[model samples]
Target chain A: MNNIILKVENISKQYRLGLVGTGTISHDLNRWWHRVRGKEDPFLKVGAVNDRSAATKENYVWALRDINFEVQQGEVLGIIGKNGAGKSTLLKILSKVTSPTTGEIKTKGRIASLLEVGTGFHPELTGKENIYLNGAILGMTKAEIKQKEQEIVEFSGCQMYIDTPVKRYSSGMRVRLAFAVAAFLEPDILVVDEVLAVGDAEFQKKAIGKMKDISRGDGRTVLFVSHDMGAIQSLCDRLIVLKNGYVDFSGDIPGGINHYLKISELGSSMNYANVATDFGIEKVTFLDKDRQEVNSVMVGQKLVIRVDYKNFDKRNLSLSIGFLDNFSNFKFACRSDVLDVTYKDNIGVAYMTIDKWPLSEGSYHYNLAVHESSVMLQNIKEAGSFRVEKGDFYGTGKLPGKRGSFYIEYQWE
Target chain B: MNTKHKDEWLYTISSKRKLIDFNFKEIWRYKDLLFLFVKRDIVTVYKQTVLGPLWYLIQPLFTSVIFTLVFNNLGNIGTGGVPPFLFNLAGITAWNYFKECLTKTSSTFTTNKGIFGKVYFPRVVMPLSITISNLLKFGIQLGIFLGFYCFYFFQGTEANMNQHMLLFPVYVLMMALLGLGLGMIISALTTKYRDLSILVGFAVQLLMYLSAVPYPISEAREKFPSKVALIVEYNPLTQITEGFRYMFLDTGTFTWFGFFYTLIISIALFLIGLVIFNRTEKSFIDTV
Candidate 1:
């Protein structure tokens, strides 16, 4: 018997670039005329690549371009990509929420998706009633939900309010209860699309832990899509990296993450607004102690950086700066939201300052991104690189004990 | 596993689907869901309202009263010796069933877009649930209708229940299927051309007047313009309403020709609706 539980072959989805309206009727009639005569769709032959940043000349764009992959039984596959890189489109097609414009998908057994939690839950219904309703919507039999209702309640920790209408429950409680019902589904193949992005950190951890158990212990095939690289690294056995509607990398998890990280390297050029959608960081400059632009800074001095950004919407953006090592490992990120940094104008400058930078002599690169509500609008890896030259420590003009990325000053007790 | 089941795939999803891709087996497997959706509809519809389930009876009662005032009293329309209240109630009862089923099932794609976009199930289940759920409402209204039926009977009226009343369930089934069939076609079309949604609202309202809901077909044929009367004569709803009134009140036109004509038309429309709905179900989410 074959172990492959799901097989996708040459799947692609094309979407009209603008509003779908009376204008499409003509094109639909044309397509129908061709189809009636046993000919291919006339419009399918021409479409632009899926790139939100670039301006499109054609009205049709392929959301997922000729996607093909397979999942083996019990293997957790991670799909990581930027917002419009066809991650959600591919998941939608796989779950049959929408069909591909071309090609097909072959599956071995039952496939269910947690595209959004509490999908069919009626807010007027009690929590207990919702369990049955949501469970049935997810393709679970009544007897199956009945058999595991107790465990689901216990897991959600909402047993006290199980009989209350969901309208009275908090949003967090709704998510917990909804996920509890879905967790007990135990389908042969589960396609999850970042549904864990909800709730607090603790519940997310518990949910991820439960998913790992489902795949590892029960041997179920899972296709997980998320932007949280930490969760992907911990939960997925294999990974697929999508870039602009194409499979950029598909293999071992570590290699795929590295490739994904390197995809945004060297975005240092000036003025991206012409091509970028919504918003993009136009320029990044590193300033020295004297407020002079420089490529390198001395260790033990302040790390001063200035980021120039532009937006079409003029909405306040949450800027993030992350430091990565040469091996593409993310060390730390400084988020503007953490420090109450915000800019409301369409074009504004953002400054990130780290007083008394503690580091040894080495080269390091930082990534820049503009975010709104955790959804990244623009992301640039290796936005700029800087070198740290040694500076006098303790006024002794002498080096620390050993040279490393981080330098620590200590005295023996 | 048997050798026959060795290479079997549970399902295959693609663009190349047959014209009538009805998944009877999938709908069967999700039978529990169908009933649960129906329960949700019945239970939640009256939640948080003051009148609650009473609203169902109030609507038909008020509509029949207005019909009595406007069409019966004002228009001087005769009911073939049957009381005007009973005459209009019978037509309204049957019309409401078809109207509710058609309107509810017609918006299946738009109303359930949130759930449909996130999950996969037999798309037919949602509309089928509407047809079934509306039956419960119809049943409750029938209680009120039966109350009126007994009130008029004991008080002595020309109308009397006969053997044709035995086909009551059959009539109800035909109306439900006809509404669902026509609604599914409108629903599938509305997924892309949303303007049809606006059109469907007034079309249904206009259709009620065109049918024999507020008046009898024999009277309309006698008084109405030839073209208008001809349209009313061929309408499937006119036949169903007329047959229902004939069965209960012992009035209106009823013939084997009209009965089979409606039966065949309803079944044909329903099968055609299923084909178009199946094709739209696959990709409606994109346009919707």
Candidate 2:
């Protein structure tokens, strides 16, 4: 039997930019007129969901556009996107918090959404009372709430303060209680929207583990949204990459991650040249093995970054490059400041290059700093990044973790 | 995994209406939430008030005092031989229930929009819970009204508080239905313009004046023998308020014509309110 629980087809949600109310009265009237005439909503037809950053003639933009997907019973679908990529809007539609402007969605079973923790918690109510209140809000019966009350309290670890009002409880305590109620209630369709962003690292880890147990152990469909790619890769069986409100990629987890990383890297480079204006440097390039400018270079190749500076004062000029790992950790820094070189020539021009990048098969960023060894002049943190594509030169080597910044070949015989 | 079992489950409850309309069964299953909502409203309403629950009685007591002073002393408003305090107290008790229910029910959507947006239950359960919770306040006020009734009766005062007072509960029920109906309509409307919200206070005040709260229907009836008295008596709340005064004080006249008129209007408004409220709950988040 086909166990399709949710089927969404060409779902699109259009939102007028800016204030939602009286500010859009005239536009609303025009929309009403177009609606009455049985024409396409004039605003929706011309606006593209993917053109959020691009200048448009109309003020309306589709927060979500042409989204299509189906979730089978007991499938955990991860939604990953950058800020303002319409992940929340899509989840809101799926959870029925809002409706789609166009297209239809057919869903089975009741949906329970933890759009935000403590969503319905009355601050004046006691912790125990709020658990029952929140449970009821999540559609649990009184008997069900009573039975789970102890478990919920135990999970929240706020048993001593059970009688205290939630307003007095700390934010972490509030989140724990809220998440406890939502998780314990066990709705058939659970829609979690970046709720893991709350609490300390330990609590986030526990919450993620709890979510994994909920999806894996229970036969409930889950839609998890987060900007944390590691969490998405770990918990989601399938991933959907949203770019400007449209599904840029949707498939198995690894492929989706690859596409998402590529899109994000391209986005960083699109504004790369604009970012180099502060420095008196005219050009910055990522050079590969054969001395060619490329964004992605093969692993274990001669990765050289050439920078051209404008001043002839080598005494006052210094160039530095920093290597950032895949998770955006700064692995190490190489600087010309360490070298005792001075440029006191008549012509004000100099070039410096790094040989043999020594990084593995993953993404790395290099930043350039041009100034006196003692006085800092210009520092571009994220100057540029290039992907180290998998290569056969070192054969297929395993990294320390399941996936990390780079794959370093170690001779451990 | 079994196709036969899947088909059987599908065929058993495949009616289109069951899918389109809200499943009241699911709401009934969530009766705990309904009870919690009611409990929250009741417990939190008088949390920080000076007298807490005693504030419920202060309204009718104060209103009774003012009525006894102004109407009996200054305006010479007759109470048909009933003590002005008892007459006014009974009217105020019944009027308080109507007014509270109307105000509470109407603000259900606006007041609870935060909760409503987060969760899904029978949205009707919210207004229903408000209508139920406001009863606690009304119940306390009614007890105070009854205390005065008993005191005056024992004092050999001719307030006429007797066996016919059993019908008081019926009057209370009608007032509740009337308030719920009107409140639901306004609650649904407030989600859009919010203009109705500001007017609700004035509307409640005006409704109190139109109802025979400080004055007995009998005196109004005697003054305007023909048309105006007929119209005043025909007012649904007026009849219900006057019915309470008639049952206890025996001052106002009661008729099946006026009672049935109120009964029909109350039920009609309630049903209309329910239909509109249900529709509004589904999409009010958009406007709200």
Docking class of 1: medium
After best superposition, candidate 2 residue A381: deviation in angstroms?
A: 0.6
Q: Model 1, B193-239: lDDT tens per residue?
A: 88889998899999999988988898888999999999998999999
The top-ranked prediction according to TM-score is 2
Candidate 2 residue B249 C-alpha distance from true site, Å? 2.7
Candidate 1, position A164, lDDT = 99
Work out candidate 2's RMSD over C-alphas. 4.0
| Model 1 chain B poorest ten-residue lDDT run | B1-10
lDDT of 1 by residue, A230-325 (tens): 889789999999988998899988678656755744433322223344466777777777778775677778777787777636677788888776
Each candidate's fnat, in order? 0.89, 0.38
Each candidate's chain B TM-score?
Answer: 0.96, 0.89
Least accurate 10 contiguous residues by lDDT in model 1 chain A: A267-276
The whole-model lDDT of each prediction reads: 0.86, 0.76
